[model samples]
Target: MTVTFSYRSRQTWADPWDDYRALRDEDPVHEVGDGQFWVLSRFDDVFAAARDTATYSSANGLTTAPDDMAGFDEKARPIVMMDPPDHTAMRRLVSRPMTPRQVAPVEDLVREFVTDKLDAVADAGEADIVEALFKPLPSFLVAHYLGVPTEDRVLFDRWTERIVQATAESAAQDGPNQQAFLELFEYAGGLIERRKADPGDDLVSGLVQQGEDVASAMWIVGFIFTMITGGNDTVTGMLSGSAVLLDRHRDQRRLLIDDPTAIPNAVEELLRLTSPVQNLARTVTRDVTLHGTTIPAGKKVLLLFASANRDEREFGPTAGQLDVKRRIERIVALGYGAHHCLGASVARLQCRVALEELLGRFPDYSVDESTARFAAGWSTRRYEYLPLTTN
Candidate 1:
């Protein structure tokens, strides 16, 4: 029997777990688009593909382009798409200030931000988590980390929204996506110039001090884009997803509330279950065979991290179930291998701090699923609006 699958369909985004489970069980390396590409659903295959950068290259791009943009070349697409030597060099340059030690100082700031946001919504009996908390918190943090002025933080949010919208089907032909990219590039360029004149103690300043060549400047801009966009989207989704998950699973919420120390473990479990980053696309560097399927060279392979995270084969029979107490060593939620999320530490820190504050302040809060809406047709699962009521 043959089954069909598509990552672009609205139904898939609405509820992807069912399709992912089917693919993992029946066709681990299922071909899609008439074998134009392959999707890997098994945990082992996804992990191996991520690590085996040699065979599965990111040089082409980290996402499968829409049919309209099929001819797009992303070889020079910054840190996410660069392969080996170049990728290593760029990643090292960007990782200096992002290390856990460097990012440690931001925890207090994150706490303060989370506290202020939650406090503002405290008086109100209800709030949209996306607008009121999850969205602003990460945008502010990303701005602070990137050295964007507080005054211009609003612009960052605007650009982020436009960019994110561009990923949706409705905005596929919209000009805002390109406009946002250009605007962001101009903003980063101006910031780089300022950093060059009077270096500050921030990530942008660090990049400026690195060098002032065309290539160096472009790389810096790309890094800035990656940090800002990647930081905001994934963190937002995870936080929103956590709220919804906990609201649904009061039992797990009780566990975390009773023992605040369990928040960290619960964060991992939430990441596994939510898996905000549903899938990432990689170019086939060479012909590779997996699960008796041969994917020819120069093809695109979609690594379904979301599926792998819930694979019963790897996470046991209860993989479909969310157990905050479940003891699991590691997960590919943040990704795996050479291109694992560079901001994983910061993201985890933000999520942990946000969850702690959220649970402490609104222990009895509940989400109104009827009022909830999720973004569609993109690699990341994010909330456009998530309404909640607090007692």
Candidate 2:
């Protein structure tokens, strides 16, 4: 038996869990599109490849789509597309502000955002979770964190969504969105210039001061774009996906509602289940053999984090099932090693705070599955809109 998969296919994105299981069981190291790329679906294999950055490089591009992979000088690529010393240096420029300790204070602001949104829906007892809470909360927090002016937050939100959609379109092989890219780059440049002169207590200002000479102006703009897209998009997926998961798995929801301290760990379980970032492509630096397949050098290899998270070898027989209390020793949901997501702490903080507030307030809330619509994306699987009824 053989399982075929391609990131460019809508069917693959529609539902990949079943195909992932087949690939893991039959061919852990599977090829797609006549050697377009190789996929590593097993937990151990994906984990090893992600950590071994030297062998599996991110310098070429992080996305699998050929169209999206073009037109970027290696030197000026986003931090996600850089490896080691350069990636290390670029990441350090803004790491301090995103650390767990640094983001602790941001939790209060997150709680406020969640509380306010949930409050608006209290009277109606029904609202689209994505629209009411999940969507705006992340954008608002990101705007505050980056020091974007309150008046310009609307523009920030619009730009982030456009960029994220453009990304999805590229992944689906729908042409690249040059307009969105240019618009965001221009906006980010303006913000960077403002930060340079004003120097506020925000991530952008910190990057300008620290990277004034160390990094190029374009890199700073790229960093800001990375932060904006990463902060807004992934967090929304995690929260909205968790809502759908919890709504389906009421037992787990009850557990979290019963014990709020368990929410943090539950967040991890949800991340693993949701697997917001489905997979990212890494350019292979050397010919690497895994599970009887020798993937040649200069090949694009995708580390299927979503499949690996549910791998039974590492997660036991109930890997496919949702178990919020399941003690997870390790999971590649956020990723691993040097390229691990920089905005991870901030994302976790936002999701944790959102869940704590949402569950506490509307424990009986049920998702109107008929109205639920998920994004048609390859890299990230998230809800476009999820209607909820508290009745």
Candidate 3:
């Protein structure tokens, strides 16, 4: 079980499609590191594992949980950490507010927000997209949805990023987002207490009166934080990555400019290639063999989705090429099966609307590649800094 640290491994882990294509062609599952777990590289294997929670299991934590949590506590298991009846109940209760349809009314506000940010940029100058738009846009939106106060929005974003960064650090090492959870619980708990006394239209108020216990409502808040953690980075990544790719493929950029309908397809291809959340892991509840490799019970197995999306076996030759016309349905980017991203539809809607509005307002855009900053963390991959120029 020797792991090869190729010059390309750095890029592959950061941008993993190439390694996945090669692995899917050769051996789909390989033991890496100290043989702690097996890496699942093919699309089917990853998809099956994500969908079939009974055999593959979820308590192991998606991607990876902090080492401290595996020892366990009762509420330590988030909805993503459960299976069957419990998972179904929890996810159903909280996910309603985040659905694409539920979030539709806010779409116009989103377009305005994106346009205003784009307008702030000079015609041919540099600006950090992450700071200027990517980080704040979704952050503010989620805050607004949760009824987080105007003064507290920045606080909410910063605290959550710290938790995510800490989770990333743990992966490199040992974490829930516990601190953020507690702060939010305290806040949501207070709000719930207040809402119990006086209710409203916000999601939190609905949960307090008729939802599960406060703990259930608490996890709903946690669930939203998870959505924010799981989503915010990638949306920014796709926008930043698409902006860069469009700049590099000037011809494609021209095509998209000429036909606004092309923006949606371009967003899909961008998602397939630049998977922001790079890895997903499942714990084995029983013995299961994938492509002839056995995964033992209780051990964690990781799905390298960032690797699988471009696997030549799955996409055939030219799997690596970016085709805007490619249909991204069923790709591992939003995941598959029951636990697939609850926010997938909302994300796509937001992205489609965002890109269309962006291009409509300013037809041509370019990223200053030299100053581009790729986000670092084994748990996630995205652009932390992408400066842009528009015409």
Misplaced by over 4 Å in model 3 are 1-14, 64-68, 171-185, 211-218
In order, what lDDT does every prediction score?
0.83, 0.83, 0.68
TM-score of 2: 0.94
Greater-TM-score candidate between 2 and 3: 2
Q: Which regions of candidate 1 deviate over 4 angstroms?
A: 8-12, 66-76, 168-173, 213-215
Error of 1 at 275 (Å): 0.5
Predicted candidate 3 versus true structure: per-residue lDDT over 1-391, tens digit per residue: 2333221222343455545655666767776655577778777788878888898777667653335245545553676677887878767766787786787887887888787876776443457877777777767666666666677777778765665555554531223455665675576566667677777766666666665654465565555556556667667666666667777877776777788788778777878877766786788888888777887787778888777777766776766777777766668887777787777766776677767866676667667877676766665676777777665
What TM-scores do the predictions have?
0.94, 0.94, 0.87
> Which of the predicted structures, 1 or 3, would earn the higher TM-score when compared with the native?
1
lDDT of 1 by residue, 86-133 (tens): 788778866866678988898999999998888878988789979998
User: Which pairs clash in the backbone of model 2?
Assistant: none
Clashes of 3: 2
Write down the lDDT that model 3 would get: 0.68
Error of 3 at 98 (Å): 2.8
